[model samples]
Target: MEESKSGTVRAVDRALDILLCFTDTTDLGLTEIAEKTGLHKSTVFRLLASLEAKGFVTRDSSTEKYKLGFRIWELSVNLSQGDDPATILLPEMERLRDILGETISLYIRDGSERIRIQAVQSKHSIRRVAPIGARLPLYVGASSKVLIAFADMNTQENMINDWKEFIDISAYKDQMAGIRKVGYATSVEEREPGVAAVSAPVFNRSHQLVAALSVSGPLNRLTLENMKDHAGLIIESANRMGNMLR
Candidate 1:
């Protein structure tokens, strides 16, 4: 019984490791996966075959590269159906959109990225690319900062170290400090070119950051001075969203 349990645990660990490898890259060959996960190539192939049979993985017949499969999407659909934070927050976000006359977005952390779950657009002609299901780096945009501010220390440290490609940690840290002091963050051209956003964090009953809410508009319309003016309103809207979830 002890040997059987040990074998089962090892197999489960390897399966989880194989699933995680799919998240780090766009596509991976079997050899590359074996190298990354330290599994024998034959063992990896068997695991991949099992996963493919269950629709948890797919192999490119031409290139032999493995990618995440449709089952992952199907699972996400079920998860999104009930207990979605977005569904709990959208009505408040729409009210924010109408009040601020800017695009309002709701985001949550998934792994190392912030995923936009909902966006309510204002009536303005200027539109943005922050549609539902869009992903953002954890150290760049206003929403991202709200996420980092409330993440675990380890994730925060990793983001602070590796996020220079988008925004430097020094700048983000300074921004976070200010947001903590003033209860909101305002960014100019952080994620989108010629766009500015003002964001605040949404907290769960446990005071964890379940999501972030942001109002975005063109730089000309949503300048730094203008953002400072609207900071109170933005924070209030976020507080209302946070309350609804609780």
Candidate 2:
């Protein structure tokens, strides 16, 4: 019985390995999985069958290839959410998206990078997409500015002093201070051409910066003036989310 249990464990381990082979790569065929896992194609097929039955994977009939399924995303959402601020903030983000008809995103600083934790793209054909799981520089963009504006003094100085591009450091420091003073920031083509965004900081009960909530869209729709016009709305939404997070 012990030997049988060990065999079952091994089968489960191999099945997990097959699933992991799809990591970073979107789709894979049976032969590709077999080669990647060094397992027989028959074994891979059997494991995939179990994974498919449980909704952990799906197979494309046209391509005869498999991809990670909806269940994977569902599980990963929970995994990525430590304090689950995204869940707490998503409703307000959706509200902002509905009101402005622009892409709404939530970004959190991870070391020197800002990561988009959640996003709701605008329904318009000419929309800007802020893909979730994207890691961007922590020193540019409206979102990046708002985040640094609320950061600790030392961190702010360290980041600015290490500026990756040539700019007036004194003026940039003043700009960051203005963001903190006014409660929001706006940018036009600062990070990407023809893209504009406004970002506001969200704080918890302790008044610590939790994230930056932003609305981004095409330049025509979210020009500097337009982004400023949307600033009040995003600031209000960010505060609402902060209240919930607190």
Candidate 3:
């Protein structure tokens, strides 16, 4: 009986690992999960079968890709939303879009990269938006700057020191300091030639950086200085979004 219990525990551990492999991405195929967990294809298949049976995951027959099921969302909503990232904060993003008439995005840092977990696209014909789930570098754009600006000292130092681009490092550091002081960030043509954005940091209850919330549009509709004009509003909205996380 003890040996049987041990085997069950091992299977449970492997199943949990398979679920964790989907954390960074929206969905994954069996082979992708196997590669991510370093488990054999057959083992991954069996684990996914159990998860699917329990409604912890769902697979699309057309694509054969598995996505987190409604049960996962049910569990997440029970956390008082303190640790929930995207869903609870989406309404604030929608509100910003209504007022700003531009794209509003929420990005969270993943190491040296930032991922857009939520986005409300502009209704205008000429608006801009980084697709949801887009993983962008932390070296450019207003949201990127805001994420780096609010990062821990070691992370900031590591990122800035590792940068090898054309921009001056000292100036970049100074810029980050300015962002920290002002509680917001702006960029024009930093990542793309005709894009502009203003971003503010969103924090969790512990004051740790949770995400960077930004309003973005084309250069003709917004400029670097003009972007700063929305800083107060952006920061306010970001703060409210942060509050919702708690």
Candidate 4:
């Protein structure tokens, strides 16, 4: 019975190893999994089969490559329903998306980078889309500016003083000034080329900056004139989302 329990634990570990291998890579073949996990091909295949049986993975019949399955998404939705920053913010984001007809995004400050936590894209043909997991420097995008504007003074100074990883020092003061004066920050073709974005900070019940809400699109739709026109609406949506959290 002890040996049986040990074997089961090992099997679970191997299965988890297979899942971990897919984190950074979108898809993987059996051989790639076996090589990356340092497991025998037969063991890898068996573990993958078990994962697939439980709906944790799916193998494409045509490509023979394995990717995450709908069950994973379902579980993610369940887990995020309570704890995700996106879950708390998406409804307001959707409303903003509907009104602006541009992509709306939520970003969280992660270390020295800002990560996209959630987004709603426009149905328009020429929409700007930033993948949910995408990460950017803490000084580039409007979301980053929002984060920086609200960050503790020590962190703000350290990040800006780190000259190696960041350029455009002059923009830091300008960004801070704009974010303070306008209650939001604008990224006119700053982060992604040909894309413009505006971001506002979200405050929690504690009045701490927890996230940022943003609107983005192609240059034609996100021009200076258009951004100025939509700025008030975007700020209002962000304020509503912040109020909801409180």
Q: Who wins the TM-score comparison?
A: 4
Better of 1 and 2 by lDDT: 2
List per-candidate RMSD values in Å: 5.4, 6.7, 5.0, 5.1
Candidate 2 residue pairs that clash: none
User: Model 1, 1-246: lDDT tens per residue?
Assistant: 223355666766887799988654769999999999999999999989999999999999999999999998999777754567788778888887788888989888887788888898888887654667776777678888878876777877787777667666787778777777877777788767899998888887677788888889899989899888888888888777767765
As for TM-score, the candidate ahead, 1 or 3, is 3
Report every candidate's CA lDDT: 0.81, 0.87, 0.89, 0.83
TM-scores for all candidates? 0.67, 0.71, 0.69, 0.76
TM-score winner, 1 or 4: 4
RMSD of 3: 5.0
Which runs in model 3 stand beyond 4 Å of their true positions?
1-82
Clashing pairs in 4: none
Indicate the residue-level lDDT of 20 in model 2: 79
Ranking by TM-score: 4, 2, 3, 1
Q: What's the residue-level lDDT of 91 in candidate 4?
A: 84
Candidate 2's TM-score reads 0.71
Off by over 4 Å in 2: 1-82, 164-166
**Top lDDT model:** 3
- How many residue pairs clash in model 1? 0
